[model samples]
Target: MAAVWQQVLAVDARYNAYRTSNFPQFRTQYIRRRSQLLRENAKGGFDPLLRRQYLKLRSQLLAQRYGPLSEQSSFRAYSNSIRSSRTTLDRMEDFDDDLRAQGARGHRRSVSRGSYQLQAQMNRATYEDKSPGSVVPTSVAEASRAMAGDTTLSENYAFAGMCHIFDQHVDKEVPKVQFANDDKNRLACCSLDGTVSIFQLVPTPPAVLRVLRGHSRGVTDFAWSISNDVIVTTSLDATMRIWATEDGKCIREIPDPDCSEVLCCTFQPMNNNLTVVGNSRQNVHVMNISTGKKVKGGSSKLTGHVLSLSFDSPGRILWAGDDRGSIFSFIFDMATGKLTKAKRLVVSEGSSITSISARSWISREARDPSLLVNACVNKLLLYRVVDNEGTLQLKRTFEIQQNSSPVHSIFCPLMSFRQGACVVTGSEDMCVYFFDVERATKAIVNKLQGHSAAVLDVSFNCDESLLASSDARGMVIIWRREQK
Candidate 1:
């Protein structure tokens, strides 16, 4: 009985192994048979013969209990077979004309038989039996010409209506002009035309109401009071003009005895009454805007031409950039009227300072304030200013652009309508680009292009809703963001 049981177990083990091997062979044979049928169907272009065979196979397999086919597998096989058959049909249809032409030529030659007659027949056949779709030079050129013509159609369609015409021409080759927006009531623009224009910002079909003209020569820079009531303009005419924003009348024009051309000017944000003007001779003069009198003992002299100037927080410190790419900070004692020179910040080689501004709401690790300066050679430099016992020092420097056109002017505001701190830069290439300085690497996120000439100035409205850009051709373009 024990021998018999062992024998029975041995036979059962052999049977199981055979079944395992046979199952794989059965699967392999089934796949091979299906593949052959699909290839035949493809070659036949899914004709009635192939379709009938496919439907019969599907029905039979589904009816079998051990078909071992999933719904996904069946669908995949059907889709692949259909795609292959369609492709084969397309190919055959494409070459049908060529096959027909070759067959016709063969029939003509088979009917044509000695030396002279055979030679003549061969020559005639060679002349008449030319290959179809012959490579004619004219046809090839025509095809190439057709392709080239289509390439330009896309660009012409894209820029179909990108042109406009306007009126009025201001012709003074302004380097850059600063714009100020105050309380949505007053709009001030300082131009190299040696004039400051203050217009009322009205709601209905906005337009310039008045033009404030006081300077003798081209006005190089200007700034507006926080209350939007007054405007200060510095010009190449060796004077800084203070004007009333409400009217086009000039309140006072303070003449600079030492420097002839005032390169830049700005009002102290904290002290709305004080204005600082920098000249080509590297000198800064602080004046009482209300009285048109220079602040007593407030003149300070440096080395290079002062290109731009800005005031730090509290109006106690001033940051000035020069044509030599050197930045200096000065401490202003409002009561004592003393100007003490501070540290000079170094910048990139071959770069000259173009514009400067101090952040308002955004503060860094420094105790005093952070300064943002734009250079002529396409870079935005960020410096951390530390106030150590009244002496301002440069703490850090962040380089913005690596290889871009030299920036002609820059404007940095405390807050932007879109998001974080924003800096707008006008370049010599007649374009304006915006930058986000708070983020690392300080990437340029947006650009405005419309100026026919080099962009001379760029500024944002107080609310950051409107952007104004002026070019060398005396064109002023105001752009507003598209509302979402």
Candidate 2:
């Protein structure tokens, strides 16, 4: 019995050492390679033989890395070995007690690091199956349909009329509107009036829940945290403020290190404690919101004033677009939050990029990771993310009037099971446009024409029941999807 206990102890020690030294590096490399292969496979351009070759290569790589540590000596196996080798019932109870204590500590660590949410987000992004039942990209829509009924074919074309119009920031020019992550009813928008209004839509007679006001100048952009507990907003005042959603109080005010107007900001999808902010001085920074300090080696200079920023679903890659019409990609270090610049694509000379949205899976029908971009070139561009290094291949372009306004667009939230996916964009033509992405020509699917001014931004709630669009004239229209 003593010998068996000693062996178990030794195994635990070895596993701990391996986890501390090698597991992290191995996991990073393995995920990187897997993501690259997934991108290649999603393109659907490779023949069966080449696909088999890729699969074989992946198997060999896994074997080479995991061969030394077999399943017999894994963490789970160690626990089972302990259970089997217990000499008496008392010893088994003691082992169970030890496991309970260890589990408590693990739970504490998971909470502190917010790892559970991160893991869930990663799983949704990387779900392999694209079936109607599979919830890779549109879990909310699927869940909504499951609760209510399956969406009908005519429902896809039912976004024509407006349900509500918020004119509180009248004539102030609202630049952005966004629905909270994983939420079906709540949404927020920032305006040139220097305030952010959060709205609740569930109850009848939807109204603004709270107005967040602290910025000295026009609020440029804002991002909601993963848990929707707080919001971070950038402003023309050259400061970024974190606001508590519970009471709409300013928790922390962080000034830009360069003392330039902060143009845009986004929460690092995997880490709410970290936010990526773009400034008018041509700098992109990764900020530790908890400490209100910039992460070391996480700052990079762009070719022009950084106008838009986006991250792939996993948060491994960041794409930032500048006023010079160039989009630059950077590799984001998940552990340290460091950024390494990777690739760049020039859309057009002197055309400002107004928005960048990255979607890993546009729909179950279209599995390619795509970037939806709005620039000053009078067109909305769609590009396929081709490689792990953040290279982009232009796939399609939809014409729109986007000559001057800082217009934005988004992938429809409930498009996963639709026969064809759709993208919605705010246009300078004073309209909201939806384009069927799979259509080869005449791709316009639906148009909402209530906004009298150039539409600046668009957002959809998690279930796609409500879409909120903001225009340049400070009008926010909430469009309801007609149920058939």
The most accurate candidate by lDDT is 2
Q: Write candidate 1's Cα lDDT for 206-266 as tens digits.
A: 5676777666687777776654566777788888887776666888878875757887887
Task: Show how many residue pairs clash in every candidate, following the order shown.
Answer: 2, 0
Best-matching candidate per TM-score: 2
lDDT per residue as tens, model 2, 8-124:
333332333334364554432333233333433444555655555654564455446544455323433333323222211122222233335667788433432433333343344
Candidate 1, residue 441: CA error in Å?
6.2
Candidate 1, pairs of clashing residues: 194-218, 194-219
- Ten residues in a row with the worst lDDT in model 1? 153-162
Clashing pairs in model 2? none
TM-score of 2: 0.71
